[model samples]
Target: MTARETEWISIPMTVDVPYRFAAGRYLTKTLTQLRDNGRIFAVECPRCRRIQLPPRIVCAQCHVRNGRWVELPLEGTLVAFTIMFLPLTDPTTGKPHEPPFVYGSVRLDGCDSVLDHLIHAEPDRGKVWVGMRCRVVLRPPGERVGDLSDIVHFEPLPDQSRPGS
Candidate 1:
């Protein structure tokens, strides 16, 4: 074998590299609240008036420490989307999910940022589009987990018409 090929295989896939992460001050308490109850928590930066999802301890825009917690709306509008061809079993239900699942970025109402979530739309190429309205559907009563997946997936809203012509 050439030196290059020999060197490539010599590297170990497993390593003792230290995993370093910025330890937050209050993430544990914040996560506990969410896991115990079905609530979406975010931090509001007093400086920029921007809310950070996942409840960041610091504001990314102004680098200021956020002091207030805000509960955001679960409903949102689909801003972008893509179809995934990968098929796999869902972790919660040990059952296989259908392929061609739609993943989308939804801009939550009353927030400046968008949250990515799974969409439950059919895989027909002609059906999905940007700016489509979608809303969160919570999991069954006994299956709540307080994670984003607690909401099964976003589905297109039904077309409601006016009362009279």
Candidate 2:
């Protein structure tokens, strides 16, 4: 066969296909309280004073059990953000979503960390950046589960500063 033909025939038969997958872990009773109750909880490391979200059973920083559930505020600033260009399929629904979906790391008030979530703003490539304020959009009161997905994407808090001043 010609070189071009040989190259085509020698191509690997199996192409790696990457698709969205649903991943979850069964939470124990203690961790489950945050999701089902719409309350934020975190573990405060006694040694370092770092409040880790998702209330860990052990403290990774100090290598101890200096962790306990602590309530956290729902509103926080957007620490960072990105606009996805490729279409993403919702793992729950298994369908391709429109491109330009905004996602960001929101630093919930009173928590010394950030939780990555969706953004409820029209994603402009030029606008997304660090330190933009965002707030959690919680699920309906009656419908909540102890899961990261329980809190929907963050929405840009209203800009209280006067527009032209």
Candidate 3:
């Protein structure tokens, strides 16, 4: 082989890096309650009175210490959503989930912050609407871990139906 053609080609490799995260005091309380009691908890700002999920010590908007803990209802309004056609890898599990699934952001009742998660609705606009009502469906208490993934998905309420149906 000629000297120019003898160049070695480098191959690309993927590394799986494992890491651990400590949920702070506020989040630890929220997650513990979620895992143990199967209930959702949010923190509220003393000044602005905005309730935020993923309970944090400080409120982002008001820039004040969050002092109040609120138990949020499972039901919420679907504020935004999209039909994901791409193979998206779930960072938590480090696995690529199947494509053409519906995922969306929901604003839980009595909470200012929105939570993003998988929406258990058909991948069609006709089935999913922006103002659709949804409730969180969590994994069984025994199967639950102290993480957001404990929520299996948000399922749409059966209030709306097709006109012909």
Candidate 1, residues 1-165, lDDT tens digits: the string is 888777755555854555555426555544555456655667789999987776777788898888888777777788889898888777556687677889899876766778887898877656777877788776765576545667678887778322331
Off by over 4 Å in 3: 1-8, 162-165
Error of 3 at 8 (Å): 7.1
Q: Cα RMSD to native, each candidate?
A: 5.9, 4.6, 2.5
Ranking by TM-score: 3, 2, 1
For model 2, how does the per-residue alpha-carbon lDDT over 48-154 read when each residue is reduced to its tens digit? 88887756656777887754566787788877778888898876667876878998888888888788889888788555557767777878766775466677778
Give me the runs in candidate 1 sitting further than 4 Å from their true place: 1-36, 88-97, 160-165
Whole-model lDDT per candidate: 0.73, 0.71, 0.90
Candidates 1 and 3, the one with greater TM-score? 3
Deviation (Å) of 68 in candidate 3: 0.7
Best by lDDT: 3
Per-structure clash totals for the candidates: 0, 2, 0
- Candidate 3 accuracy as TM-score: 0.90
